[model samples]
Target chain A: MLKKILYSLTAVLILVSIYLVFFYAPIPVDPKSAGGDPENFKIFYFHLPIAISAYLAFAIVFVSSIMYLKTKKQEWDIVALSSAEVGVVFAFLTLATGSIWARSAWGAYWVTWDVRLNTSLVLFLIYISYLMVRQAVDEPEKRARLSAVFGIVGFLGVPLSFMSIRLWNKTTIHPVAELNYSTFSPLLTTLITNFAAFFLLMASLIIFRIGVEHLKEKGNEMKRKNSL
Target chain B: MKFLHIAWKDLKAEFRTKQMLNSMVMFSFLVIVIFSFAFGKESSIYISVIDRKIVDLLAPGMLWIAFTFAGMLGLSRSFAGEKEEGCLEGLKLCPVDRSDIYNGKVISNTVLMFLMEITTIPLFIVLFSYEIKNIPGLLLVVLLGTLGFIFVGTLLSALTVNTRTREILLPVILFPVLIPVILSAVTATGVLLAAGSIFEIAGELRILVIFDVIFFIVAQLVFEYTIED
Candidate 1:
């Protein structure tokens, strides 16, 4: 019953978010450029929400990873892996959309040593490498334990990289972290809805991914039984 | 004491075989040689007539790059010997806690990394035609940075020890966490080599110091979970 509610809500929220961000919300203007990012800044609505969702997914991974370590439960491991896989997808979208936005606003796709972008890039790399590490290990239990350790360690980069960027931003020539729209703007309304939509979407996707894993496990078990 | 015993056992084995140390030193030498032709003050290359200033700007980053990749070799092998021989199982049988085992690996690993640097640093000076005026400061930064490197490296080395892709997996797991370590090491080395103000170098050094302390404790506490069956 609850699953039905969640599925319907996710579908509605996603459609609403797309409508609001694409049609209802006003496009953001770049203060640096003439005529502003009237068209390009539109990606901000999608990029920002997905980025936040990615962070949320990783936080879930961290908590579930910790719980897995404490209890030695396979369920928690499944939760972490599911969250991470979803997180990696969302993270890639965020980076891709962000680059598009950067190209329009900054006139370049990448700027080296810019703390915020570099931090995001590094964060993306760390988790991708986490998935790689997971794939490299064969034993299920051992893989879970090792990947859990990595999940925890990789998430530490989120806060640490931010701090390093903020502190070390002084020496570098790159522009400071982006602050596109001011607070209390109408855009905030769309941003909030998009945030909610992405959260629901992430939750829904995690459930499906975990369902897929469970199905795979069941199939493996049936194969073993049939062999017997 | 048991932790020391594990470390001593590793050291004794290494002393006899010299397997990890020899490879690490040679790898650093090879990397430095390549780096020199690419960045050395006087070289015949497409990026020709590279100035002293450019080399100064680059030396810290290059030096640490060599240290980091070479250190990865040592860290990966530090556990390869244990996992390959099924020696970790024997160690597990002795009833020592995971913390002891972790510290044992970190200590032995740090010592071997230092031994590699003993040879690699001299080679770096000769190849780059560089002289270290602030030897003590550079040493301090290297020690703090290397500790942070080994702390994360040893943990991930053990984490990947049982994996099919252990060789490739160690650096994948390690280099990301070592960002602060490597960044600060480069920054501090640049400052010291360029004879910048103490105030200028202090921030980067502080970063290395903090990284070493936090990661050392974190690695010890968390390592047990990684090793569990």
Candidate 2:
């Protein structure tokens, strides 16, 4: 019942958020002066939330990974794997949407001088490697243990990569969109609504993925019993 | 410590066989030579237009490519011997902690990486006719940078050893996490090469130090997990 409610709530929030982002929020008047496109800036509504959701997903992976290693529970490993898969998708979306926004806002689809872009690229690569690590291992127990170790180590590298890239390129072309929430603007409302929507969407997807993993495990168990 | 003995055992065996050391040195030598052929005098036109010596500009990047690519070769093979003779099991049967095994591999890999670097740097100097303005600062950057690389590399080396395609997976997985070390190290090397003082590279130095320290601790904590059966 909770899962069904979560799925429907996510659907409603997403529809409402999309309406708010397109028709309700006010577009900035002075975007170009600040390196933003007046229209393309709307992508920010989805882009930032998607980026945050990716981080949230990876944070879940990190926590679950630690829990798996500590408790040796199959559920934690399943959660870690599910969250990592979802996180990788969200990360790729973040990069793709970011590139499209950059094309209009920064005059380039990709900018090496932008620390955020570089860091996001590294984050994407690290998690993709996490998935790759999963594929390369055959035994279920060993795979879980090794990937959990990688999940921990990879999370630690993100901040250092960000710092080093920022230090390496002292100049940045990435715009900082500072929203004024003091007046309770429609923009702020839409942004917050989208954040909730994406978080719910992430949760719904993870729960679904977990169910699939359980089914797969059951199938494997049955196959083993039949063989015996 | 017990880890030092493990490291010593590796070195003693390596000294007797000289297989990995020879291949690492040769691979780095080839990397530098190929880079020289590709980036040497032919780009003089572009270099002239830019009013900077191409060799001076590209030397640090070239050096680190040689270092990392060669270092990757050594790291991928670091656990091959242990896997072959059930040596990993024997090592596990010993009376030391699992982290000791990790530290031991890190030391041996660091030593091998340094040996590779020690050979490659002079060859780089000769091939590029590169002159170092600050030797000690450069060496310091190289040391911290190499530590960060080996700290993470040795951990991932063990991690990948359990994989089916260990060789291919090592570079793909290791390089992204290694961006910080390679970026900071290459930049610091550039600063030192351009006759800049160590003060100019304080930011890069700090990044390298933090990366080395963080990965050292994290890898130590998780090392046991990677080696588990």
Candidate 3:
């Protein structure tokens, strides 16, 4: 019951934050502005946070993979799978929001050799492969173990994917710098609040996914008992 | 010692069959031919005159592309062949450490890759009209790059061999994670081709070395779990 309440609270926070982002926050200065137009600035507030959250999701998967390897327990496998599922969701969101941002900023929807873009595409494919590998094998234990190993290996690409832009000299409008605290106004405050809210939303989604997996495991156990 | 013994056995088997070597060599020749035709006759002659630099620039990409595809072919066959022959279960039940199995597989894969590189470098020179200047640096990059590929490939092949779409799945599964290595190799080769001082390409070289170390450690650590029932 308490878990249910926490989950509901997290959902509310996320919804309210989304409302604030779209309706209440002041429009930001246009990133392209030589003089400071603000129409295109709105994407940054939403887009940056979602991209960061996607990375956070991958980090969670990486940590959970290490835990699974160390403990060799099924619960950690659940955590790893949950994190991977959420990572994929956030990764998809990142790509979508980024493409929109790119259209406004770069005047195009996609670029293939762009290192960050390619790496993200690759990361998404790797996770999809992870899911496929799990489905391909029939033995549950073998599936879990193999998936965990792949999860760990695949996460190695995350940093490479993230850093590929810097390494390859690709152009992106996203600023790689600390936010200027002095520039903060109510709009910045709201953006930060929304950022925190989305992160909590990601956490809640991962928790829900783990809970679903736990219940499925229990159902399998019960069916086995009945058969016996 | 035990790992080396197993690795030796794989080498012996490879020598007897020559299947992986033959395919990789043929594929390398095919890629060079395609590149030559794509470049056309005059450009091909010019490229051959500047052959050393062009080959140096293109070699890592060509080498890795060939190696990656050939490695995939080898990897799928490595374990699937074992399973089909009913040898994998027996091998697993033996007293060998799982890491030994990984080492053995890597050794054999690396040997095949090395052979392919050795055979193809001459063929690339002849077919592409590339002069083999800076042989030492070229060989060094090939060695490091191949080791990195084999390190990751061994583990991925192990995991993918059991999958339903093992052949198609290995490259998708392997390439994304190995991009850093591939990128560094490409960059380093380009730098070397431009006659950039060794100092200039050092950054790319360092990245390759770092990836090689990280993947090596991770592969060794994870191989046990991947192979376990």
Give per-residue CA lDDT, model 2, range A25-134, as digits (tens). Answer: 87766555236557887888899999999999999999999999999998999999999999999999999999898888777889878788888899999999999999
For all the predictions, what are the DockQ values?
Answer: 0.59, 0.88, 0.56
Q: How much native contact recovery, as a fraction, does model 1 achieve?
A: 0.52
Which has the better lDDT: candidate 2, or candidate 3? 2
Over the stretch A51-79, how does candidate 1's per-residue lDDT look in tens digits?
88998999999999889988989999999
Q: What is the lDDT, from 0 to 100, of the residue B39 in candidate 2? A: 79
Query: Which is the leading candidate under lDDT?
Result: 2
Better of 1 and 2 by lDDT: 2
lDDT of 2 by residue, B1-229 (tens): 8999999999999989989999999999999889878875743334464544656678788889999999999999998779988999999988999999999999999999999898888988877665787888888998998999999999999999999999999999999899999999999999898889999999999999998898898887889888887
Please give the clash total of every predicted structure, in order.
Answer: 0, 0, 0
Name the candidate, 2 or 3, with the larger TM-score value.
2
> Candidate 2: deviation at residue B206, Å?
1.0
The whole-model C-alpha lDDT of candidate 1 against the native structure comes to 0.82
lDDT of 2 at B183: 95
The reply for model 3, stretches above 4 Å from the true place, is: A30-37, A111-115, A161-165, A221-228, B46-63
Best by TM-score: 2
